[model samples]
Target: MIVFLAALLMILGLIGRMVYLMVFDAEYYQKKAEDLHERERKIKAARGEIVDTNGTVLATNRTVCTISVIHSQIKEPEVVIKKLSKCLGMEEAEVRKRVEKVSSMERIKTNVDKETGDKIREMELAGVKVDEDFKRYYPYNELASKVIGFTGGDNQGIIGLEVRYEDYLKGSNGRILTTTDARGIELEGVAEDRVEPVAGKTLQISMDYNIQMYAQQMAEKVMEEKQADKVAILLMNPQNGEILAMVNVPEFDLNEPFTLNQDQEISEKSKEALNQMWRNGCINDTYEPGSTFKIITASACLEERVVSLSDTFSCPGYRIVEDRKIRCHKVGGHGAETFVQGIQNSCNPVFIDIGLRLGTGRFCDYFEQFGLLGKTGVDLPGEAATIMHKEENIGQVELATMSFGQSFQVTPIQMAATVSALINGGKRVTPHFGVRILDKDKETVRELKYDDGKHIVSEETSRTMQALLESVVSEGSGKNAKIEGYHIGGKTATSQTLPRSANKYISSFIGFAPAGNPQILGMCVIYNPQGVYYGGTIAAPVIRDIFDNIFPYLGIEKDVEMQYTN
Candidate 1:
C-alpha cells in the first residue's frame, strides 16, 4: 500500500512540474536564455559584387564597423556614452538610452567609417564593441543606379538588379559569443565561439560599362533638350537577346537612392515623388508605340502573304473605316506607292488596308505570335504584361487604328525584344541581363540559359522587312538616325496619348545596324515632350548619338564600302 501510494504521488508531482514549466516558468526561462546564451555579436556577411561584362565593378563592398553596447559588460557607462556620442554623431541622451537597455546588448550605430571607428577604439571604453562589417558602395555614384540598385541597413537588397537577384547576392551572416568578466570586459580566450559567414557569389552581367555610360549621356542630353517628363533607352545584341545598355535618365545615386532630382516645383510631395523616381520606365510604362509599331504590321502582312512588295496603295490622307475616318500622319497622303514604299513612309492608310485584308482573327493571331500580347520575359522584376485587345471584340475602327500602332499599349522592353526578333532572322528571344553566375574566386559556375526563341516570321519575310526598315533611314523619315559608315535600318514612331483625350505624345525610334546581318539593335523613348514630338526629329538623333560611341567601342568596324564621314 505504501509503495503504490509513493508511485502515485511521484506521477502527480511530474504533472505539476510540467504544468509549471508550460504556464508559469516558460517566460522566465526564455528571459534567462536571452540574458545569457542569446547575447551574441552578429558578423555581417559581405554582399556579392555586381560586375559589368568587362569585369569592372559596378557594385562592391567596403569595410565598415558596427558599434554596440552590452549593458552587463559596460563598466564606466558615462565615459562610454560621452566618447561614443561624439564619434557616432548620436546625442549623449540617445547613447545613454541604448546603454541602459535591459536587453543583453544594444546597437549604438552601424556602418561607422574607419576614421571614426579608430577614434572610438583609441578611447578603449569598456563594454563597447567595434566589430568589422561591410557597406554596399557604388563606385560610379549615379551611373546605372536603377540597374544595380541599393541595399538596406541589414544589407538586404531593396531595388533594381539588387532586389532581383537578392538570393544570390545576400550571403549568410555569422555570429560570435563571448562571456563577460567581472569588470564587464570580454575575458580573453574564455567561452568564445564563432560561426564564420560565407560571402555571396558574384553576378556577371552582359552590360558593358562603357556602353551603359554613353547611353545614359545621350538620354540625359535628350531629356534636357526636349524637357520631357522622362526618357527610356535600351540597346541589345539582336542575335542573342543580350541587353547591352539600358538607361532611364534622371537616375538617382545608389549611394543616396532616396533623394529626388526633377524640375517638379512641389516642395512637399515626398513619398509619392520618391517612388516615382525609382520606377524603371523601360519595362513598367506603356505607350501606343505610335508609327514605330509599323514594324509589327509590316511583318504580319508579309508573313500572312496578304501583301506583296509590288502591291500599290493610294492614300488620300484618310481612310473611311465604317462611319469614322482615320487620317495618316502625312495629311496629303502617299499617292500610288509600292508596299515596300508604304512601309518606308510609315503610311497609316496603306497599313489599315493591309489590316482589313488580313481580317481581325488573323491579325490578332499574328500579334500574339509576335509576343505582343504578353511580357518580354526579361530577367528583371515588375515586367508588365501587354495591354491588348480581346480576340472576340475586334471592330473595323479598332483594326484601322491598330494597323498604324494605335489602340495598343506595349512596354519599351516588349517593343525592343519584338523588334530584335524582326531583324534577327525572326527568332523571338527572351531578353536577359545576367550572363553567368561566378564564385568569389571569379570562377564561372552557371551559364545563363535562354529560350531558343521560336520563329515568328519566315527568314525571307525577315529579310524583306529589314530592307524596308533600312530604306526608312536611307530615304525616308529616319534620315537623322544615319551614323557615318554603318548601314542602319530604322523606323520612327510618334504616338498620341489617350485618357481618351490628352494631347500628349510619346516619341520613339527603333533601329538595327549593319542591315545585311544585324548584330546590334536599339530603341529610345521620350515621354511627353513640350514642342516637337516627332520620333524622326527627336528620338532618332539620340539613337545616332549612342551608335557613334557604341559602334567603335564594340569594334563593329566601319564599312569600307559605305563610309560616310561624320
Candidate 2:
C-alpha cells in the first residue's frame, strides 16, 4: 500500500506540470502560427500619363475590378469552378486545376470591369472575392503607336517610349505584411509595412498629334503608291532640334501587337522586321547617304579653304584615281562646272576632286566634327552610329565617294540634325522628342532647349552651305521639292544597295521648310522601290506633299516678308 501511494504521487506531479505548460506557454505557440500565416501584400501605385505637346492624353490607367478565389472558403469546389469558368470565359478544366493548386486558398482572375465582377459575385460562390486594380488604356489606337509604345501584363513598358521612359512611368510599389486567422482574414493587430509608393511622373512629349496623324497618313499613302518595302518620315523644328512628328509605315497597334507577330521564334528576317517595326527608323537605320552627303563634302572643302566657290572641274564622264574609275551620275558626264554648279548637278567627279583636296586627314577631321562618326545620342533607343569604314582604305577614290555620301552609312536623323546645324548657323544641337517632364501637380521638372550648342563650323560656312542647298531646289536636281511661296532647300539621295546585288536602291529626301527663317526640318526614306528609285523621283515629292499640308495646317506664315539678307 505504501509503494502504490508513491507511484500515484509521482503520476499526479507529472500531470500538474503538463497542465502548466499547456496554459502558460500557449502565447508562444500562437505567435509562431501567426508568423506562418503572415503575408506581405504589394499595393501597386498607378502608372504615369503620357501626353502630347498639346496636352492630349495618349496613354493612361484607370481602376478596374478583379475576381479572386479562396479554396478554404469554397463549399463546392467543382460547382464553383464550373460557374467561374462559364462567367469568366475560362476553361472549366483550367479553373479546377487552379483551385486545386491553392496551398492557402488564394487565386486571382486578374480581369477588370464591373459587369464581369458582378457576374462572378452574383453566384454567391464561396471562396470568391472582388478587388480593384489599375489597367492601362491607349486612346490613340494605331496613331503614334510605335512612338508611344505600350505596357505589358505586368504593367511594365517593354518598348519604344514606354521602355525608354520606364523610370518615370513605373511608380514605386508599397507593401504590407500582417498576420491572418485560420479563415485567411487579417487579425486586428499591429502589422509590418513598407514606405509609401511614389506615383509616376507625367511625360509631356514634343509630338504634335495633328502633324503626327498627317505624317502617318502620308507615309501610308506613299507606302501604297511606291510599293516600298519600308517608309519612314520625321518632322522637326530645325531651329530648335525639337521633333514635331515621327512616323513609320506598317505601324503596329500597341493595344493589338499580336496581329503583327504570330509564333515567337525569332529569326534574322523576323528580327529585322521587328527592329524595323519597334524602332524609330530615323535614328535606328543606317544607309549610304548617297548624294545628300555631297553637301558635307562641299562644306569640308569650303571650310578647309581647299576649294573656292568659283573653282571649276572638267569631267569627261569619269575620273581615274589609282586605276579606279569614278563615274558621274550623268554617265557621259556633266562636262565643265564651277563649284556651285557641281553641287547643283551633284557631279560625282567634282566631289571626288574636292575630297582629294580635303585629304584623308582633313576629311576625317570634319567628319568627326559634323557628329557623323558617332551616335546623335538622341533620347530614343537603338540609335545606330554612322558606319565609318576603315580609315586605312580611305584613299582619294574612297574620299571622293564619301564626299558624295557613298562610302559611309548614316541615319536619317543624323542627316537631318547635321543638315539643320549646317543651315541653322553651325549650331550642332542634340535632337529630342520629349519636350519636358512634369509631375502630378503639373510642375515642370525638366525642359529641353536648343541653345546647348556646339559650333561645328564658322557662320560663313553655314551660310554658304545653306545657299548651295537652296540653289539645288531653285535651279538644280531638287526642283521637284520647290514650293511656290516658300524658300525651300533640300538634298536628294539615291544610295545603292550593298553587294551591288542586282542593282537595288534606297532613296531618301531631307529638307527644311520656309527655307529662310526655317520652321520644320523633315526627312522621308523609301527602301527598295520596284521602279524609279531616285531620291528626287520618290522622296522629294513626298517632302513636297508633307510641306504642302503642314504649312497651312500649322498656321505658319506662308506669305511672310522675304528677308533677302543672304
> Top TM-score: which candidate number?
1
Best by lDDT: 1
Which pairs clash in model 2? none
Tens-digit lDDT track for model 1 on 1-566? 99999999999999999999989999997776545543477888889999999999999999998898878777888888888888888889988999888766688888899788877877878778888899999999988777777998788988778988899888899999776544345666676789998899899998999989988988998899899988888999988889888899889988877654432454676867877788888887788898888898889989898999999999899999999989989999888998888888889999999999989999999998998888888888888888888978779999989988899788999999998888778899888888888998899988989896799988888888788888889889999998877789999999889875888999999998887678889899999888999999999999988888778778787774532221
lDDT of each: 0.86, 0.80
Q: Write the per-residue lDDT of candidate 2 for residues 283-388, one digit (tens) a residue.
A: 7788888998887888878888999889989978888888788788788898889989988888888988888878899888898998888777677777888889
Q: Output the lDDT of residue 472, model 1.
A: 89
